[model samples]
Target: MYRFLLTRQWLITLLIALLLIPTTIKLGFWQLHRHEARVARNELIAKALTATPEPFDSLSPAPGTAVPADLTWRAVTATGQYDPAHEFVVRKRTDANGTIGYFVVTPLKLSDGKGTLLVNRGWVASGDGAADYPPVPAAPAGEVTLTGRMRADETAKGSGGFIKDRAGLPDRQFNLINTEQQTKETGAPLLGGYLELTATTPAPADQPALIPEPNHSDIGPHMAYAIQWWLFTAMIPVGVWVLVRREAKDRAKQQAEPEVTPEAVPA
Candidate 1:
């Protein structure tokens, strides 16, 4: 009865099952890796947020060099004059309330005259027309000291992910808060990382809302997904066993049936 396992169809099924087990196991491990990475990131963010604020320039000394991954979300401060003339808005950003808007990125001229730093002031709702610029509150005038979380520049390879860089956007509109791009636009030397403005000295009467700290408490569904994939991997062999048993039983039932013989003496 078990000989049916050697049939072409069953052989193919078994081969497929063999292939899927390892594949599914690998997939499960992939999800597990993602889960581990997320947990580590949360821990890093939590630690950085709690640490003492440092000078923004101290975090990255070289101009235009990318911020170190471990320093992301680290508290930092800088004293600078807001250059509103070169300020630009990043499209497709959202507020804490999940409202679609643009992020106002203004270049801050360092008071030391060393290099400028980009500051993401906050989000503003879209205007009546897509081409029409949204009314962003003016940056506080004069020199000011501000504290914020340090963030890596938004590039295709940066924390922002693989965002496509498009051209021909509206006036003063941008895709990402990249120091390299902004350095060229402002015609000024720029520091590596930008700041997500949290507070400023002599706060303006009307300023864009401050961005909130990112939630690091959530680890997401990666672990659950990993368990599910592993469970699916385990079920494959059990499923094949059930099929083999059913086939064997059917064969046995067919063989055990009595066969009737014609009556030989009726003629």
Candidate 2:
């Protein structure tokens, strides 16, 4: 059976099977690693959300500087004035009640004499008509204290993108990322990134409130997928063994049969 498996035709098949086993195992391991990474990421996000927001000034002197991992989800308080003229709407946000809406992000000019930081104020529902934006209450002007979590600025998008410009506010439609472009439009020296405000406290009656739930991505499914790949790897050798044994049994049965001359044979 071993020699038969080594024959040119069978050997090719065996080589393929052997090669596939390791490859499958490697793929399984890769998935397992990804599963662990997702778990870690989820944990980090959870930890950050629960902790108090740290001071925005404590992060760094420049835009691209890395903030320590532990500081990511902490609650931060900043005193600033909201610049509604520089505000932009971010597309595709949903609320805790599963209502579809857009995020209203406006620049908050910090009172510390440092430049402005973009604030993701809250979500607003699309009103009755496509041209209608749900009424957003006027932001408190002149040295307002806002609390939220810090987020990195969004990178500028490449050409052929989904964001398109409009002539006016409240009725405008666009997928705004970081406030860099909006700040440039307003000629304001804005902070590098934006802050996602949590709705821990109530805003003025007419203002849209922040959604505070922590977002989670699933890791369990990936682990199950990895196990499936490993099982396939284990099945390959068993399949080969069964095929070889069946072939051997057939050969043995042929050899054990007695041969008779045509004259001696009964019809």
Candidate 3:
């Protein structure tokens, strides 16, 4: 009964089914992990966002290379002068509604005058590139203060690579939020992390519009996706069994019938 499974097509089917079971199971587990991570991040964000703004240096010292992983998303404040010459636009930022735009990242020279901090002013709509650059408000000159959430340097995490300066944009344009990379451009020591500018002291005449608040409530469909993949894995063997059983039945019928021979005739 099982001999048919050794045939070319049946064996191929068995092999594919065997391969898919573990693959689907592993994918299902991956989705579950994604869901769990989202939950943990949300819990962290809920606490971090509400906390009072603290001095930037208190979280991490000045002229540092990277922010601690656990300290990200915490509210922090810094005071410095804008280094407009070193400013660059971070492209492809989007709003909560999914509008394509760019962020103007400017370095804030610490009042101590020894180092600088990158302040992401905010999002601005992209232009037709008929001109040299996107229209963004200039960072104020002289001493200024900034307040916003803490975000770890992009290089600190192994998320993805940054797309370097794009073509046809203004002179100073970048595709990364990586402070480490931008620090090299600033020609000054950096504090390892950048501020997502929320407010400024003595509000400037111009400022980038606020970026959309992050969505923390969505656990996404990972759990359901995982279950669906697992369910499909479970059905693979059932399908193979159906085909094998039908083939066996056909063979049985052929064996049950008697073979007929032509009657001998005068030759």
The CA-based lDDT of model 1 is what? 0.90
Error (Å) of candidate 1 at residue 230 is: 1.0
How well is each residue in 165-263 modelled by candidate 3, as lDDT tens digits? 455655687777776677576656777788888889979998889775577788889889989988998898898889889999999999999887676
Clash list (residue pairs), candidate 2: 52-74, 52-75, 53-74, 53-75, 53-76, 116-191
Residue pairs clashing in model 3 are: none
User: Each prediction's TM-score against the native?
Assistant: 0.94, 0.78, 0.84
lDDT comparison, 1 vs 3, better candidate: 1
The residue ranges of model 3 lying beyond 4 angstroms of the native Cα positions read 61-64, 112-114, 128-131, 155-170, 258-267
lDDT of 1 by residue, 68-131 (tens): 9999999999998999999999888889998978999998888887778899999899999878
Candidate 3 weakest lDDT stretch, 10 residues: 155-164
User: What is the full ranking by TM-score, best candidate first?
Assistant: 1, 3, 2
What lDDT is obtained when candidate 2 is compared to the true structure?
Answer: 0.70
User: Model 1: residues >4 Å from true position, as ranges?
Assistant: 157-162, 260-267
- Relative to the true structure, candidate 3 reaches a TM of 0.84
